[model samples]
Structure formats: structure tokens, C-alpha cells
Target: MKIMNPSLDISWTHCGDGDDARYGKSVKRKVDRVESDGRKVLLDTNDSAFDFIPTAEPSPGTIEDK
Candidate 1:
């Protein structure tokens, strides 16, 4: 699997209903990648049932000086 951001935090939630309702819970994951068509791939699993939102905070080094 191609990791676009190893440390990136992703808040994923299943958007499916009915029989797939069991998977309709929000969870957080670290490993993620973005497809060329603007789809978020989580853990290398490509499923359209979930929507991913990036929740990673900026690194300390990127936010403040040492």
C-alpha cells in the first residue's frame, strides 16, 4: 500500500445504511493515502462506504521554533 502520510490522523465514518449499518461508526486511523481522483484510501482499503476527514495537528517543529 502507498502511504501518502504516515503520521496523518484520519477520522473515518461509514456512510452506508441498512445491512451495512454495523460499519457506520466513526473511528480514527493514522495511516492513509489520497488517490489521484481525490479519494481517501485508508489502510490501503478502497471502499466508497466510508468518508475520511484529516484530523492531524501540525507538527511542533512546524508550529513553533526550538
Candidate 2:
């Protein structure tokens, strides 16, 4: 999935390496942003993996901006 904002861009993809016994599936995330000098900065370009858990909805009384 990809998320874009006025000054930031974020994306992630599944690693397909299978799920862990405790942490769920594997995923890779990248974050990029535009600097004030009109340069694009790669905030995260590493191959690190993160655990992802699927959620159906937010907890009760969750406040959302959008």
C-alpha cells in the first residue's frame, strides 16, 4: 500500500516470506519526503523487515483526522 501527502510519501509491500509464530507476516516499508530545498530525501531505504498484523477496525472511540 502507498500513502501520499503534500510533503511526504510512504509505501510498503509484503515480503512473502511467511508469517512468524508470534508477530504475524513480514513487510517492508519505505518513507520519502521532500525537503525545503526542493530535494527529495529517502528517509528509509534499508531492507529491514517489520511485522504486520491485520486489523478489522480501530478501537472504540478512536479519533480520526480524515
Candidate 3:
């Protein structure tokens, strides 16, 4: 991965061994990652919404906790 602009670009690469590349179904499989040279991937989760609930009004003889 690399920082080229306001965002980052990522890539993937994989190869097989022992004549596995002949059939194209290589024994090696690469997964999508933020780093290619075996480095830690920094990522954060984003919440799409705010969760808030309004409290009910106190009744004539109801007690509320502060």
C-alpha cells in the first residue's frame, strides 16, 4: 500500500512453487492487505450512526436517579 493522495492505493501479488504455476491454479494465495512487505496494517472502524435514547419524563410520584 502507498499514500499517493487523499487516499491510499493497495496491491496484491502471489506465486506458486513446484510446478504449480503450470496449471495457473498456483498453490500460493495472497490476500488483500494494507502492506506488501509484511508490515502492520493500521485501520480503524467507523460508526455510521449515533445511538442515543431520550429518558422518559418523571411521573407524579416517580423517582429518578441522578
TM-scores, all models, native as reference: 0.23, 0.22, 0.17
Candidate 1 C-alpha error for residue 41, in Å: 0.3
TM-score of 2: 0.22
What lDDT tens digits, residue by residue, belong to model 1 across residues 1-66?
354453342323433344554353433443366678966555534332233323333343222111
Per-candidate count of clashing residue pairs (backbone under 3 Å): 0, 0, 0
Compare candidates 1 and 2 on lDDT and give the better one.
1
Worst 10-residue lDDT window for candidate 2 reads 47-56
lDDT of 3 by residue, 1-66 (tens): 553442232332333334643343322212224456765343322211111112223244322222
Per-residue lDDT for 45 in model 3? 21
Off by over 4 Å in 2: 1-14, 19-29, 45-47, 50-66
lDDT of 1 at 22: 36
lDDT of each: 0.38, 0.36, 0.30
TM-score of 3: 0.17
